[model samples]
Target: MNIILKNIKHISVNEGITINKLEQIIGASKGVLSRAIAKNTDIQTKWLVNIVKNYPQYSCEWLIKNEGEMIKPTGEIFLTKENIEETAINYKDLAESRKETIDSMKKEIMYLEEKIENLKKQNELL
Candidate 1:
């Protein structure tokens, strides 16, 4: 079996979750993980990203390189200086994206409110 898949299986067992449940938690399609694990094939990087995002207690370095402890002590990620800088940039980008989404939603809400007000005025005239 591929080392990464092996580690993932170990994680599933450690967390007391079945493969199907892990797929659901990671938002992966049914059979995505199970099939790959069964076949010992590679999975996409996005699935690895989702796993890290969903299970923050696990060490990504360990998952990728198998160099560190599988689970992080104190539930905090052990990060190098470069990793810390990269994470800061990622957070900045994420914040900007969320702000744009919020602005767009606000505009949509305002437009809908105006439409409702217009409908109410038209009803009053009828």
Candidate 2:
């Protein structure tokens, strides 16, 4: 099993939730997680991000790197100086990745719009 999937399973089990329930909570399609878990395949980064967002009690470091305790202590903030620096770097990287995706999507939309315009012109001729 991928380490991330294994950790996710651990989180689900600890929280007394099933994989299907976890999927719903994370806004993933049904079997998205189950199939990945069953096949020991990697899941998308967005799902991982959603899981982190929804389950704040679990440590992102532990989910990604298995470096810390699975469940954070109650009322304890997970951030430290090192974590802050690392998170800043990660945030910048995520921002750049998202920007690239948005740019690609914009290009695709423009192409589709041009195609639609051409089709309309041809229809008018017909």
Candidate 3:
């Protein structure tokens, strides 16, 4: 069997979800995945994306690159409103942190440019 098919089966088994349920979650027609696997044909990327969307606990890296564990070790994902609020706050914090880092880097770049100009002047004098 193709590695992709094997991986898909492995994911289904690991998730304790039947192939039929997987088809429903991914919105693929019944037996479509099985047919692709049996034929050893490549599964389309959109199908993979659907699977990822439906099963966020599964590692997309593993699905795509065959790297990392099939299931992510990250903490549980809850679809509750509290979790959503927390996630939004976390994202805002991350955006602020990244903006600060970019500003610092811009300052450093200006400092470096000034030093380079000074060095150029010294070289010209010599």
Q: Compare the candidates by TM-score and give the number of the best one.
A: 1
**Candidate 2: 10-residue stretch with minimal lDDT:** 86-95
Where model 1 places Cα greater than 4 Å from the true spot, the runs are: 75-126
- Would you estimate the TM-scores of all the predictions? 0.59, 0.58, 0.56
Q: lDDT-based ranking, best first?
A: 2, 1, 3
lDDT of 3 by residue, 65-110 (tens): 7788888886744466755664465456456656776899999999
At residue 52, candidate 3 shows an lDDT of 71
Model 3 Cα displacement at 88 (Å)? 21
The per-prediction tally of clashing pairs is 0, 0, 0
How does candidate 1 score on lDDT?
A: 0.81
The digit string of per-residue lDDT tens for model 2 on 11-99 reads: 77776567886787678999999999999988999999988866666888899999889888877656567556754654564566567
What global local distance difference test value does model 3 have?
A: 0.74
Stretches off by above 4 angstroms in model 2 are 77-126
Tell me the TM-score of model 3: 0.56
